[model samples]
Target: MILSGMATPTRRSVLALGLLGCALPGQAEEPIRILTEEYPPFNYTDKGKITGLGTEVVQAVLKEINLDAPFQSLPWARAYETAQSTENVLLYSLNRSKEREKLFKWVGQITPTDFYLFSLKSRNLHINSLEDAKSQNLQIGTVNQDIGEQFLASQGFAVGRNLQSSAKYELNYEKLKLGRVDLWVMNELGAYYMSRQAGDDPAVVLQKALRIPELSGGGNHMAFGLKTSDAVVERFRKGLETIKKNGVYDALQRKWL
Candidate 1:
C-alpha cells in the first residue's frame, strides 16, 4: 500500500523473511554490534545499564525482527568513527545530513529532535536570533554533537572549549555558574535527559535555535547507521516501516517520553 506515495510495512506482510537475513544459511543468530554515544534521554547509562528512549526503541525494534544486537556506549566522536571504520556495526540517533547520507546504511528513525540554544536564565540575554549572540562570548557545550558542531564551525563561532562525552551537560551547567561560558547548544530532549542524569538544575535553558540550511530543509531526523550496503539498508528500512505502521513507534514514544 501507499502512504503519501511511500511504501508502508505491516507485521503480517514481512515479504519473505528468507531474503531478510533471517533464514540465510550462512548467517548466525548472533547479536549485531551497535556503537552509541550518551545523548541523554536518547542514549545514556543508568546504574551500569544502558537505557534511554533511543536505546530502548532500537532494542525493541531489533527484538521484534529477531535481530540480536548489543549496544556499546562510547564518546560520540569515537562511536561515530567506529561505526564508519568497523564492520557489521551501527550507530543510532544520528542526524541526517547530505554530507553523511552516503556514509552509512541508514535505518529506523528513533525520533524527530529539535535543536536549540541554551543559556542561563539569569544571564538576562535575549537571543531573538542567531546573530544576536554573535557579539557575546558564547561557549556552546556539545560532545561531538554532529549538527551542533558542524553548525558552529561553519558559522565561525568560537567553540569555547571541548567538553568530555559524559561531562558536556553538567560541565556547561557549572560553566554558567562560574561565568565561564555564555551559552550552550543542545537538543531540547537531550538537555532534559542530561539534566535529570546529572541531578542538577539547568541554570541555562534553551534560548533559541541555530537556523542552518541543512537542518531547516530536512528538519531533524534521528536514525540508525550501518555500513553502506543495499541489503542491510533495505532490511532496516522495512523493519522501521513495520514498526511505524503497527503503532509500535508511537506507543514507544508515549511510553518513554
Candidate 2:
C-alpha cells in the first residue's frame, strides 16, 4: 500500500543517503543530474563548490524522496538539452512555457519569481507601463537563450546585445550598473539576490515589475524537469507533495534567501 502524507526529508537526510549509497552493494544509486546556469543566490560556483538556493531546494527534494543526487553548473542551453534527452536528468528554475509542456515531467513550484524592469536609481526613468519602455531608448539585459530573451525578441523590443549565460547573475547586474545596458530584466527574486551581491548602492532600483497577463498567473511557475518516465515522475511528484506539507521548503527558503 502507498504511504499517505509522508513528510519530506531534510538536508540531513541527503547527507545520510549519500553516505548510505556508498556503503551498500548490489543497490545501485542513481544521482539526479541537474542543469543550471549561474543565477546567484540560486546557483553559483564558489570555492570549487556549487551552492545556492536552487541547489539547496533540489537537494531537499531529493532527500525527501530518499534519492542520492548532485547538481552541476552547466551552460543553460546544454542543460536544457540534457534534461530533455537523458534519464534522471533535471533542470531547475525553468520558466514553464507551453512550448515545453510536453518535453519533460516537473517537480517543485519552488519560488514565486516576479520579473521586473530595473535601472540606476539616479536615472530619472518613469515607467507607468511596458509601452512606456518603447518610447525611451531602453536596452534590457537578459541572459542568452533565456525566456526573457525570447520574450523580448518576440516583442521586437530590440533590447541590447545578449549577455553571457553564466551561472552567476551578478555579471549582468554589474553590466547594468556600468551603463553598458540601459535596463535589466529578470525575475524578482533573482534581481533581489543580484542586487545584494552588488551591494546596497543607491544607484540601483527596480522601476517597474511588468507582468505578462498571458503567462500562467502573469508569472512563471518554476519546476524541476525530468525525463518522461512514469515511475520517476510519480516518485518525484509524491516526494514534492510531502515536502510542501512538511515545511521543508519554507525552512530552506529562509536559510538561503
Candidate 3:
C-alpha cells in the first residue's frame, strides 16, 4: 500500500531538493563571457587590455562576488548577437530601451550619454527637431547595430536611402567629413572621442543638429542573457549597488564622464 502525506515530500521540500541537486558537487557553474566593443572611454582596448569606465565598473561588480572574467572586445553586432544567443554572456554599455526590455536580464546602469545628430560646423546646418531633420532628407551616418541606428530605424529612417550604416563609428565620422553623409548620428561623448582620435577639435568640426533627449536619458546598462538565473543577476545587481553605496561608482563616473 502506498503511503500518503506520511511518506510523500511536500512541494516546498521537493523544490528544495531540486535546488540542492543543482548545487551538488560536479555540477559546475559556467564561466561568464563578457562582451563589449570599441566604444572608447566606456569600453575599449588599450594596449591589449580592455579597460574603460564600463569595463572597470563591470570588473568591480564581478570582483565583489569574487568572480574574475576578462572582457572580450568584438564587433558590436557580433557581440550583441553572441549575447543574445549564448548563455552566461554579459554585454556592457548597452543602451536600455522599451524595445529591449524583455530580451535580456539587466544588471545595472553603467554610464550616462546623450545622442545627437551632428553636422559639420562648416556646413552651418540647423535642425530644431527630428521632424525638421527628416524633412530635409539628409543622409545620416550611423554605425551598424548601434543604438543610434536603432533609434533612427524606429523613427522610420531606412538604410541605403537616407541612412548610411557603417561597421564602425570611426568610419561614420570619415563618411561625414568626406561629405558622403550629411549628418552623423552618435552619442555626444562618442562624437567627441572620435573627433579627438581624428586629431580634430569637436567644437570646431561638429555642430549638434538635433538632440534626441528621450533616447539619451536612459543611459546604458550591463545586460545578461535571458537564460541567466535570477540569483546570478541579483549578485551583480547587489554588487553594483554596493559599489554605488561605497562610492566606487561615482568615482568611476567622475573619471570617465
Ranking by TM-score: 3, 1, 2
Evaluate model 3: give its lDDT: 0.86
lDDT of each residue in 57-138, candidate 1, tens digit only: 7776676666766778887777778778766677887877767787777674777676676666666666666566665545
- Please, what are the lDDT tens digits per residue for candidate 3 over residues 85-198? 888889998999877899899998988889899999999998887777778899999877888888889998988888999887889899999999999988899889989989
Model 1: lDDT equals: 0.64
TM-score of 2: 0.75
Residue 174 in candidate 3, Cα distance off native in Å: 1.2
Considering every candidate listed, which one attains the maximal TM-score?
Answer: 3
C-alpha positional error of residue 210 in candidate 3 after TM-score superposition, expressed in Å: 0.6
- Per-prediction tally of clashes: 1, 8, 0
- lDDT tens digits, residues 1-257, model 2? 13333434555688888777672432224555667777766777889888787677777777877777666887777777777878777777677766667766766466555666677776656677656666665666777666776666666665343332333356667877788776677776677766766576333464443555433343333344554466667777777678778998788778875
Which pairs of residues clash in candidate 2, taking residues 3 or more apart in a chain or in different chains? 9-64, 37-167, 38-166, 38-167, 38-168, 39-167, 114-188, 121-203
Query: Which stretch of 10 consecutive residues in model 3 shows the poorest summed lDDT?
Result: 21-30
- TM-scores of all predicted structures: 0.76, 0.75, 0.87
